[model samples]
Target: MSRLTQAVVLLLFGGAILRASLTDLYLRYVKEGLRPFLIAAGVLLIAAALATLWYSLREGETPDDHHEHDAPASGAPGDDDGHGQGHHEPRVGWLLILPVLGLLLVAPPALGSFAAGQAGSVSAAPASDSDYPPLPPGDPAPVGLLDYASRALFDDGKSLTGRNLRLTGFITPASDGSPMLARIVLTCCAADGRPIKVGMTGKVPLEVPADAWVEVTGVYSPHRAKDPVNDVDVAYVEVTSWQEVPEPKQPYS
Candidate 1:
C-alpha cells in the first residue's frame, strides 16, 4: 500500500479510539480512570499520521534510495528475490479493523452476569490494620456490595449489624441460595472483573433476573458463625425493602 493509505489507517484508528473515550464508551472496555491516557494515545496517533502525510508530501520524510548495494531488480508480480521486501502491504494488517469497527458500530456492553459466572473463587476482604468504620449518619447508609461483604465475612459482622445500610448492584441469582444483591469488582479492567455477592433476607420479595440492577436496604442477617477456613462473604442482608433502579454509569465497582 502507499504511504498515504498507511497514514489513513492510523488516522481512522486513532479517531475511533478518541470518539470512544470522549463519549464514555471506553468504560465498556476499561476503567474510567484511563480516560486521560486513552485521549493522549489517540491524539498522538493522529499527530503521527498527520506528520507522515506532511513529510511524505514535502519530499523530505521518506529517505532516498541510498541502497548500500543494488536491490535485486523489481521482478514479476508473483516473484521474489532472497530478501523479498514485497512492495505490497501484508493483508494481515486489515484484521485490525475488526476491533475499531466493533467499537464504532456495535458498542458492546460492559462485562455482566455471563462474565461473573466464569469468575474464580470469592474474594476476601483486603487486609487492613484498622477496624471497619461505622456507617456515616443516614437513614439508609449507602454502601458498596463488596464493602458490606468484607465487613460481614471477615469482621464477624460487627460493623454491619444493626446498621441500616443501602447497597446497589446487579442481581446474582442465589446469592447463597436465593436471589441476592451482587456487584462485579474489577482489579483493573473488565477482563479481570470478579463478582462479589451478598445474600438477601427480611420481608420484601426479590423477583429480578440475573443482571437486573436494584438498590437494597436493610441490616445484615446473622448467618453461620464466621469460619477462618471457609469464607462467609456470601453473607445475607435482611432486606427491609428494595426496588429496581437504572444501572450505574460505570457498572463494575
Candidate 2:
C-alpha cells in the first residue's frame, strides 16, 4: 500500500488500543474476548509503520517527485551538482505527544461503585435444571462464604435458605454506623475479587483484625431484612471456622 495508506492503518490501530484501554466496557468484557484481535491489530500496525518508513526513505517517483517548480536532481529537481543531497522536511517526532500525554498523565481509574449501579444486578438465580448437587436437608449445608454474602445482600438470603457453603477472603472493617459485616472481594474469577459486605452474626475471632485475610467455613442463615435488590429478608451465616490466610489478586465477585 502507499505511505498514506500505511500511516492511516497505524493511526487506526493506535486509536483502537487507546480507546479500549480507556473504556470501561473494554476493561470488563472486551479485554478477555478480543485479546487475540488486539494482538493481531498491533502486529499489523507495526508492520504497516515499518513499511511506510522504508517507502519514505527509498528513492521514489511519488507525486511530490513530479513537481514542476523544482531545483536540481540532487539539489531540487534539475539543477544537479552531483554532490548535493536533496533536503526533505524533518519527520514530525512531536506527533506522538498526544499518546504520550494520555499514557503518562491520564491513566485510567479502576471501575468504581459508579459502575456497579449501571452494570445490572448479577444473576444468582437458581439453575433451571438440577445442575447443582442437592444439598442435604440437615441443619447445616455446604456453601461458599462469598456465595452466602451475595445472596444476603442481593438475593434476600435466599442463596443460603436451604444450603451451607464454604468461602474464604480477606477481612475489612465495617464503616461507622454500618451493620456488623465483613467484606471480601472475588476477583478475576470468583476467587480473586473486590470486597462486598458479608453480614457477620456468629462469633468472629479477636485475633483476626481488620485487613487480616481468612478462610471461613460456615452455614448460611438469615441475618437482617435489608435486601438491596428485592427487599427479600437478608441474612448472615453462622461462622463454623475462621483462619487467617494471605490475600489473593482479582478481588471482587
Candidate 3:
C-alpha cells in the first residue's frame, strides 16, 4: 500500500474515473455504452498512477541505490521487522479513501424513487410477439416506460389502444400515494438497476416529487393492477398531460 499510498490510491481512483467518465456523470453509474469503457479505465488508471509516481520518485532519489541492492537491514527507519524502510501500511489501506471520496465529492444521484421503492416487481421485458407495432405517428407518441410496460402488460392494451403516449419517467409513489411512472432499467450497472413501473391513470399528478422528473401525456389504460410487491401486472396510463421535467441525461433505461 505505501508506494506513496499506492500512488495516492491510484491518483484518487483515476481521478474518480475521469470525473465520472467525463461527464453526464457516467450516466449516473454506467451504461451509455459504458462511456468508452469508462474512458479506457480512466486512462489506464491515470497511466498507472503516473507510472507509480514515477517509480516512487525514482526510488526517492536513489538512496545509494538502496544501499547497493539491499542487505544491511537492521530496523531503524520506522521498523517492525518486515524489513522496514518505514513500513506499516495495512491501516486497511485507509479504507480506500472512502469510495474515492464518494467518487470525487458527492457523485450519487440516479436510481431514484428510493430505487423504485425497493423493488419487487415491475422490471418489464415480456412481450415478445403478442402482436405489437402501431403507435408511431406522434400526436403524443414518445412512449417507453419499457415500451409502455411491454405494451401494457403483454399486449392486452393492444399496442396501447388509442395511442396519445409520450412518457419520460421518475416518480414512484403508489401503495395509495398513487403516481407511479418510473424508469430505471439498466441491465448492466447501477448494480443492475430495475424499475419500469407505469400506473398513472387519468389526470393524475398529485404535485409530483418522489424523485420528480415527469412529462406524461397519456392514454393506454386497460387499468390492470396486482403488483402488491410482485403479483406482477401493473400497467395503466390515461394521464392526459403532466409536466415537471429535467432529470434526464441518461437517468438509466
Number of the top TM-score candidate = 1
Off by over 4 Å in 2: 1-38, 55-123, 134-164, 170-196, 205-213, 225-235
Candidate 3 lDDT tens digits, 1-253: 4565677788889888888888888788878997888889888988998897899787783423433334334544534455534443347867988998988889688888887878855556665665788877868888778888887777777767876878898888878887787888877788878787888777988887799888989788877887677777777788877999899889888
Model 2 vs. true fold: TM = 0.44
- Please list the C-alpha lDDT of all candidates, in the order they appear: 0.72, 0.48, 0.78
Q: Write the per-residue lDDT of candidate 1 for residues 46-87, one digit (tens) a residue.
A: 999898778667764333232312334566553464466534
lDDT of 2 by residue, 190-243 (tens): 223233445555656545655555666676665554435443333466676666
Q: After superposition, how far is residue 252 of candidate 1 from its true place, in Å?
A: 1.1
Q: What is the lDDT of candidate 2?
A: 0.48
Say which prediction, candidate 1 or candidate 3, comes out ahead on lDDT. 3
Q: What are the root-mean-square deviations of the candidates from the true structure over C-alphas?
A: 4.9, 10.0, 13.6
lDDT of 3 at 43: 86
Better of 1 and 3 by TM-score: 1
Worst 10 residues of 3 by lDDT: 63-72
TM-score of each: 0.82, 0.44, 0.37
